[model samples]
Target: MRLFDKEKGLFISGPEKQISCASQIWMILAGVTDRETGINIIEALDHCPDAEGMSSPYMYHHRIQALIDLGLKDRAYREMHEYWGGMVNRGTDTFWELYNPQNPDESPYGGIVIHSFCHAWSCTPAYFLRKYYY
Candidate 1:
C-alpha cells in the first residue's frame, strides 16, 4: 500500500498526487504502519498546508478515530467536545452533515437550504466519546 511523501511529510494519493487527511486517517485505521509513524503522519496532517482541509463530517470522524488509535485520547476528546459542542451551542437539535466553525453557514451545496442538519454520519462523536473517553 502506498503511503507518505518523503519530501512533504504527509500521505499522498497516487496518480493525482493529492495529499488529503482522509488518506492518512484511513492508513492509520488499516493498521498498516507503526504507531509512531502513524502519529507522525497524523501530526503532519494537522500541520499540513493543504488548502483542502477537512470537507466533511465523515472525514472528521476518521481523523478523531485515528487520534484515539494513536493514544491521543485527550486531544481526540477535546476535538469532539469542541466540534460537536459548537454545533450544539448554535442551537442545532441534530448534528449537521457538514460544519466549519470558521464559517457557520458553510455548505457543500450551492446554498444552505440543501444542507442536512441531522446527518447520521455526524452523530458519531457520542460513540467515540462513550467508547474511548467515558
Candidate 2:
C-alpha cells in the first residue's frame, strides 16, 4: 500500500522519494502482492516520467525474472534486446555493470574509466533465455 502511489500510478520512488527497482520485483517473486497488483506494478516500473529506468543489470535481471514469472516474456525479451542489445551494438564483448542509454557513458563510480563493462550479473540473459525460452 505504502509503496504504490495511486494518483501517479507508479512506485513511490525517484525525486519524490521512491526506491530503485529491486524490492518490487522481490515482492512479486515472494508472492507479496496479489497477481493483478503485481502485474500492474511490474508494468509500471519506470517509477516516474522523469525517472531514468533502472541501470543495473542486477535490477534488470530481477525485472526480467518477474516478467517471466508473470508470463510477460515478450516484454521481457524486448527489454533485454533493447537494453543489452545496445551494448552489443556498441561493439561490446561483455555486459556492463551499469548502463543508461540516455547517458551512454555513465558509471556509478564516477567516470567511464572506472566502469565494469563486463559485469558478471549482466550475463543473466543466457540463463533466463535458455531456461524459459528454449
lDDT of each: 0.81, 0.78
In model 1, the Cα lDDT at residue 3 comes to 52
RMSD (Å) of each candidate, 1 decimal = 1.8, 2.6
- lDDT, candidate 2, 54-120, per-residue tens: 7788888888888878888898999888888988999998998988877888777878888887888
TM-score of each: 0.88, 0.83
Please give the range of 10 consecutive residues that has the lowest summed lDDT in model 2.
Answer: 44-53
Model 1 lDDT per residue over 14-125, tens place: 6978887777788889996789988888777778787257756788898898888889988888888888888999998899888888787887688878898899999778
In model 1, pairs of residues that clash are none
lDDT of 1: 0.81
Prediction 1 TM-score vs. true = 0.88
